[model samples]
Target chain A: MHVTEDDLLKFALETCDDAEAQAIGEHVAACDECRERLALLRRDIAIIAGVQPEAERIPLPFRSYRPSVWRAAMRMAAVLLVGFVGGLAVSRWVCRCPVTVVPQYGASAARAIAASPQAVTPAPPVDLAATSQ
Target chain B: MVYPKGTYEVSDDWRDLDQARHGDEAAWRRLMERHLSRLVALALMMTGSPEFAQDAAQEAFVRLLKANPAPEQGTLRGYLTTIVYHLALKENRRSARQQNVENSSLEDDSPSALESMVRSEREWLVVGAIRALDDAQRTALVLRFYGEHTYEEIAALTGVPLGTVKSRLFYAVKQCREWLKEKGVFKECM
Candidate 1:
């Protein structure tokens, strides 16, 4: 049987699967009418494709700051800013911080005593061993 | 039949496009020279406005250079056309909104618009024939023939199923064929 226009269209588009392509291929090779029809379809395709109007050279990256370009750049910049802030927060949550909100005095009780505005006198460390004995 | 692979000799497109991605100005120019006209044509088909078409084409290149969005399934040309197509649609919407507000005529005063007005009779006839189609069919037809895209690429770009794309292609070609025959330009051009 002769191929339909749909079959020929798919063949022209190269959309047929391999087996169907082979079948169409054998048919078109042997059928003069199908071959001529394919040629005409190709010409129509060319007429459709070939109507491009001529153009001058478009200045490339020289004018890269066009709306679309910087708009994307701004978008990427915004994404990076969000990522950095998010990562900082996540890292802070995951890791231990060396410093704390409240200050702790170590071993320098005298300095702590002097530094404290409410201090009357220094409190000595209790000797637990002597007390136990 | 030994079909021509693509209407454009786009072999160097990938290599130059790769270089353009990394700040190569000359390669970028090469890519632009090779593809800009076709992209502009696509934009024109999509938007029907010459100025918007030019802007859309430039925007596509800018997106390519800046965003560097590689296609997962189609070629770089297809990717570029997809960008132009979307940009054209967006710009068309914005234009429509402004027209709605200001109530201006749809005349485009761009030089390209004037140039297209005086194009050859055959070109005008072809454009008229294409414009006669419905929006969906026209888009499918332009992408398939002018973009030289496969059915898969057209389907992906249009976000339609394979069968739908095939049907659109069938109706679009059938309409254009009938138009050409009616115009008596088919036999004359051939």
Candidate 2:
């Protein structure tokens, strides 16, 4: 039986379980070509495994992270501050009017009221003399 | 020091995560202290850079805090690793884009100067070999070996089919083996 490069490669990668691995191992030990292929595969895996970066130091507690509290507080504070400022601006816009415009309108309204006699009195008398005449 | 009730006691991580979800700052802090290191290592392995790893891990924790914590439903490590994996991938994409732009601007066609500064010959060779792997294969290898995630966990986190995950692992190991052999490391080891 002939074993292709793919079969040997797959076996070398340990994709096979105990039985297949054992078969491939037995065959490779006897076959020079398969043995060379296994050797090459082993070397590459080793290089890749070796290339992995060293285990890094565990990260300190996030609380220990500098400026964390301040940053979080600042973020919350900024949001609150914006909300507060926005509310204040809206309230101010709604409540107050320009003094000049208010008085000008007020004066005109007052003059109109004063000019209309019926506005000050309950009812103006009709011209009884003219009616009689 | 007078310890507050329930503050000094070390509870199970899932319990702590649940408590933290319910607004227990101390529980959250304790959980972070316990798991931050492993998370960082995983992030670094995934991102291939310490600074990016740090940021990614931090971002993952932040997301965890903001998320509805359901520690009972899954392992904390799985949850954290999933978050870290996504953040690391995002950072990788961002950096890759930046690198592409930089590489495009540079006139020199030789091997990158960044590639030259890895210091250790073996380390450089390994990195080069890792870079040669496809993204999925590289991710699977890093998560499986470096991050120490089980196949099931990796499959869940990566959303790849179980068989696909296994196949990727097999091929990745194979590729690594071949590369190392080419570099003569395996012969030396034998």
Candidate 3:
């Protein structure tokens, strides 16, 4: 039977059984075209096998890579801190006090203010006599 | 099957994986040393970037450690490789999407001038050709060659049919061969 490229590749890779390998070997010895194809396949296989197998050492203590507990805690703390500071600023802004002058009243309202005990201001006794003089 | 009887020494792999899961530092180190390079190589083949491959490999190990009911024995390496493969695929897809949005090429495709200067080396050329392959082909070829897994194993790892794995590997090798020839690396052999 004529050898196919698949047969040649299998033979080259040594995946074929010994009997099939022998059969292909004998066939390739006689068939010029199959020999050429087998040679090329062998070359490709060699290149693939020749790759460097060395790799860098594994980083010690397999990094589990879970989110850090401390980082989450810090994030929570940050939020609370901002809230606290913001609340303090708002309370201070709301609690400020300022002085203002009270408005004067009309005649009847003045008499009522004179009669009230909480009104402690005494009118000057001679103010009307001084104005008349 | 069963690590091919004597191809590699993994007799203690199950024990080591058990210890690693339970917080044994030395066992974890041993496991990483034994499998890191291969995992990285597999990722590199799939993602076409050394940095991204390393990241994917590291992520795979981290996930392996975190997995409940950890993977069974004699299959840890395959399990890890499969994880790395999936991670690399996701990373590649995400980067591709971002590149599309930005109207920029993937970093893998835009090597610096200094990098271009070193393309003449045989290893780099081989790697470049491997990178040029589509994801399916690259995965099949790398698992078959780098991971040294059988087509059946690859089929199981990739969740595809046996026939599809075979076809992907066949075409992957063929494509890489053609690429090598076009680059004049294997012109004399052809």
Candidate 4:
């Protein structure tokens, strides 16, 4: 069987298992096509491996800074402001009081007054028995 | 494979990185000393300029120092390499713009015979071919060869899918091989 390019690449990369590599090695020994491809692949890999990026002498003690006190304070203040505003908005939305007549006005009279346009004093509370009846 | 064994006294980079994150000066220095060459090399390969490569390496370390919640996955070297790659890409774009501006005003922008001769050297040809590749392909190739990262490690470090990493390598290697062949660099001799 002809050894595939993928197999040759893997073998070049040393990613193939030993047994698989052995099989490819055996095939490559006999097949000029596979052998040439493998040779080119290895050469390409070597060219890449040969690249030496010139190194710079980084003087010890990397000059990096921690957040200054003022910056930290500012960040904290911003967080607190956001939290406060968010809490206030949430409380207003979730805990708003229901709109209802004042307690001095009975339910029926409150409804009557609300329905009418006339300006009048709130009615006294109705007796429980009367309201139930 | 990029980082030889015993190059670092402390083997676990994450530990040193963690310490550095917590304001340990020695730990930070250790990390810098260990990975500086690799990062510089990565940037050099990407940008093809020593000055930009140095700048990219330094910038990556500076960014690393400032990074809150420092990279948690992959080796520190891989993380630094990713940073260098990005910085180098940016540097390359900026330099390309400058070069274009210069070339537009010049009557003859083509390389002279001497320049071409020097560039036709094996190393120069390889570097040129590598630089000619798209950013994604170049990055995968560098990570695989220079960083010596496995495909899985490369995917994790580069934030690409494993399949994408493999595909990038396949195309990158193919392109390099074809380029080398055109240059009459590839031969039957193993």
Candidate 5:
């Protein structure tokens, strides 16, 4: 028929239910002292609940903010990729050796040219006349 | 007693979260709508700053959106809370360090006049009580009461022994009661 402080506190916090809660409720209704204790417990709970933590301004749902930086980065990457491909293509195309054509000579001409290598000029006409004389 | 209808919608928001994770912009917006308020509230309580709380909540959702989908493991809310808590704690440390530096700079002068004297008193009592608790107890109290996490979730999140979590919660509440009594808040009740 007596509700203790612990029982009252438990009841205040709703820690008790069913049979125990019913019993506490019954005692609280009948007993003046228990009623006062219940009132105090209610007050304490109220105070605890009332400790209004500053109204938490619900933050705006983070806008799906597309940072310009990200777009810029993607752009940079694309540019780099294009530059790399372009450089590769240009390097492949530009670095070939030019083909050269060589002139062909007749076999006799080649032989005459080889034989006359050391500074051939028409021999002086006198050389044949002198030989004949 | 039958609970009110729609009071416990099966949180289909998870589907939206999954879609968002898979790159659906519309789904991402819906996901944010469903959970942003709750996340902000939790973050505000944990970090005690509106700006920081917003940043942490936003960062958490962004992380959730970007993270690989793992629908089989848990609810998106749980995952988001975990991320927010981690980020908020990180921010708390940084801010605390900054505050320490600022406080030290003003150490030789008079106490801060702008601080809310009444609220600070109440906060000091609560924080002091919390400080008196062991790490496990303090962590459980913060996660459960401040972060609004369930016991099983707290245990899972903290990776602590479940029994340890239970005991820590029990003792933390007990300590809070005793501390409030000492402060005369619960004296009349006793």
Candidate 6:
């Protein structure tokens, strides 16, 4: 029977003890299929190693980098500056020309007051003098 | 491989050793600066907790200094890797024993949403797969690949028989490969 997958992997990693190594090596030498599997296992070993934990530990200068206090303060300052500028622009626009309030009709409306000549309504005059007498 | 094949190339590793041996704090600091991150990563692999991992790594370095007066004549990287690995593995076992209930809950049959979120990014995908492995398998895998130790060294370091080490490594790699394949990492990334 062919060697087990465990044996093949061990053989590929060169971890088999002397006797095991010799036996596996002999079997692999005699078998083309085992040889191919061993090659594949060897490749797998390398691939696993590539993702090994230590591989991620390269000393990156900015790895533990937090934004400097000054930088953060500067960012806040910039935000405040932008907000202030925006608020000033809005207030200026609003002050420059308020929207016209057309009271009688169109778009925005309100009840007309007698302050306008057109708003005064006519009513019948009573005989005040005769009533008083 | 993250650790290069053979003794890790540290020229100052030896050059500064004499000073480090003579109670020079600066020399020792230099050594620690050189090797601490790698040691921490290895420990993190064995011990999942960053807190415990950091402790294990630091303890390993201190133990090497205090425990072995005449430290083994090899690359400092090798000794540090070995020490930190052992420390981390011990912590892992202790924690595993105490937190069996909590850990059992974590090992549910189906993958959790957190586990299955390893989409697109190969690093995250591989990390998830590695995390999937049980402690023993993960230890064997990390020691072999990251530590770059030979079978004999791994066996000796782990205090396990060569056969056990070989088998653990085999299964570890096999499982990792299966997980990687299942996630389509091979086709998508490399």
Best by lDDT: 1
Worst 10 residues of 1 chain B by lDDT: B99-108
> Can you write out model 1's per-residue Cα lDDT over B1-190, one digit (the tens) per residue?
2234335555577778777665677988888777777877677666666677777778777777676655554478877887877786677677744322122222433435736642566665566567667778888878876566777777887899987887887677777777777887687222
Worst 10 residues of 1 chain A by lDDT: A95-104
TM-score for every candidate vs. truth?
A: 0.65, 0.48, 0.59, 0.54, 0.49, 0.52
* lDDT for A123 (candidate 6): 45
Q: What share of the true interface contacts does each candidate keep?
A: 0.26, 0.21, 0.28, 0.24, 0.04, 0.19
Report how closely model 2 matches the true complex, as a DockQ value. Answer: 0.11
Against the true structure, candidate 1 has what lDDT? 0.69
Arrange candidates by lDDT, descending.
Answer: 1, 3, 4, 6, 2, 5
Off by over 4 Å in 5: A1-95, A98-133, B1-11, B18-34, B44-50, B95-135, B146-152, B177-190
DockQ of 3: 0.12
lDDT of each: 0.69, 0.61, 0.68, 0.67, 0.59, 0.62
For candidate 3, the TM-score is 0.59
Where does candidate 5 chain B have its weakest 10-residue lDDT segment?
B1-10
Which lDDT tens digits does candidate 6 get at residues B1-190?
3224434446677655555545566766776666665565566556555555557667766655544333347766677787887676577667734433225332432234323422335645565566678767777787777676777788888789878887887777778888788877654211
i-RMSD of model 4 (Å, 1 decimal): 5.8
lDDT of 2 by residue, B1-190 (tens): 0111123333387777666655567877677666565566556545556566566777777776656457455666667777888888887777744333223222221234323324466665565455556778878876765455677777887899877887997777667557656886455322
Model 3: per-residue lDDT, tens digit, B19-42? 765557788788777778777767
Residue pairs with clashing backbones, model 3 = none
Instruction: Give the top-scoring candidate (TM-score).
Output: 1
Q: What share of the true interface contacts does candidate 6 keep?
A: 0.19
Task: Kindly list the per-residue Cα lDDT of model 2 for residues A1-133, writing each as its tens digit.
Answer: 6466666656755555678778887888888876886666555554454332332333334443334567789999999999999999997775554332222336777788779866653244454434443
Candidate 5 residue lDDT tens string, B29-78? 66666566556655554544556666777787666655644768676667
Standalone chain B TM-score for every prediction:
0.75, 0.61, 0.73, 0.60, 0.59, 0.68
Give me candidate 6's TM-score against the actual structure.
0.52
Of 2 and 4, the candidate ahead on DockQ is: 4
